[model samples]
Target: MPSFSGNEVTNEQIDELRDAFERYDLDSNGTLSAHEVRLALISVGYEITEAELYDLIHSVALYDLIHSVAVRDEDRLDLKKFIRMMAPRMVHVDSDQSLLRTFNMIDRDRDGYVTVQDVRAIMVVLGEVVTDDDIKDICQAVDMDGDGRISLRDFIGFMHSPI
Candidate 1:
């Protein structure tokens, strides 16, 4: 877990942020410019407007200054910095109905559980160029019981897990 401003963030959130960062690091440069960051957040279903993005980053920059942490470089953010910036924002999506909606979207088969196949299919349909291993890793991250399938209970727990 990582802590920022006295707030702890879980490993699962960090992992998801890392994945988004990697996906949107279009140049494979291990960093995301503001434009890339916007795309990444939108990909993950965060409908942030440009104004909101600017405001969030400005606040994050102030936090960085106070904490002596360099979260950006020439308008680009690396994986670690991106995780630190996103973890708190991610926590607000933990409402039960929102989580249920997200779970249902991923559980394409409507089988009461989310499996690798469902995730992979969704990625494909979304035109995301993710590898098979990436899909497996995503599923494994939320499969709290190591069962390779995520039930609604597991989904809720993952969404609301204490940082």
Candidate 2:
């Protein structure tokens, strides 16, 4: 998504922002906490601290434009406002080359495809426990061709998906 300095915003940008906000609304609440916002940021590869995150929420002009009128409480922020604050900086690193690198890194077998088992094993190594059903759901999501595995094409599609 491109950054806009003018008052005008495209419908596409608004949609993207809305989608992002909803995804980060973990409990389906209409508001976002600093912690939820932080997790969303980390998911997109940002290494932010609580202080810095607050600096963004408190100081950025974008925050002003995005803050909801219903924001009576300072502790939590409205999801729609959060969306506006994030949409401009919502850069998805899902380019072909980037996805290729990610796929290659995760595909340990070098068999030209990635299986749920591969990811499960990697997660284990990282001290994360992933259930079989979770892995299966993950594969189902990226296995666009129903091969029970993830291909580069499928990965690109996953990266391009709204969620």
Candidate 3:
């Protein structure tokens, strides 16, 4: 599945999302309704329903992202924002600054630590399945100190560790 997170999105990914948006925006308008999103994903060959969209994206994260740019009209949303929010995380950069930037992005609330909710939000947003088991797996993989959270050091190690 194609995924993106924060500014880690590559130019190719942006172009692809733009193309998908254009294809879905049949009326040539910048906004999209629930029906429009359904049709757009279908056009791109995804076998999904409107309800499934909600399930695929975490409820809190998806609502927060959508409500930020929510339209006054019912079921209307900024398609671009939805696509961007759904993009997966990619931390391929190797510089210390890059690692810090990735940490900040993942930290979301600037809490200096990565929580399970934070990780699940990004994963599910980017079209990845984030089951309860997957959350535990991620914790084991990145929560080096075993404190049930990913500290700055742990996050940096995660970014630097081999994918």
Error of 2 at 86 (Å): 1.6
Candidate 3 lDDT over 28-116, as tens digits, reads 77866565665545433354656886554444345565668443443554665556544542224224554576567668899899898
1 or 3, which is superior by TM-score? 1
Provide backbone clash counts, one per model. Answer: 0, 0, 4
Candidate 2, residue 92: lDDT: 43
How high is the CA lDDT of each candidate model?
0.73, 0.64, 0.60
Query: Higher TM-score: candidate 2 or 3?
Result: 2
Q: If ranked by TM-score, best first, what sequence of candidates would result?
A: 2, 1, 3
lDDT of 1 at 54: 77
Q: Which candidate number maximizes lDDT?
A: 1
Candidate 3 regions with alpha-carbon error over 4 angstroms: 1-94
Candidate 2: what lDDT?
0.64
Give the candidate order by descending lDDT: 1, 2, 3
Error of 2 at 5 (Å): 5.5
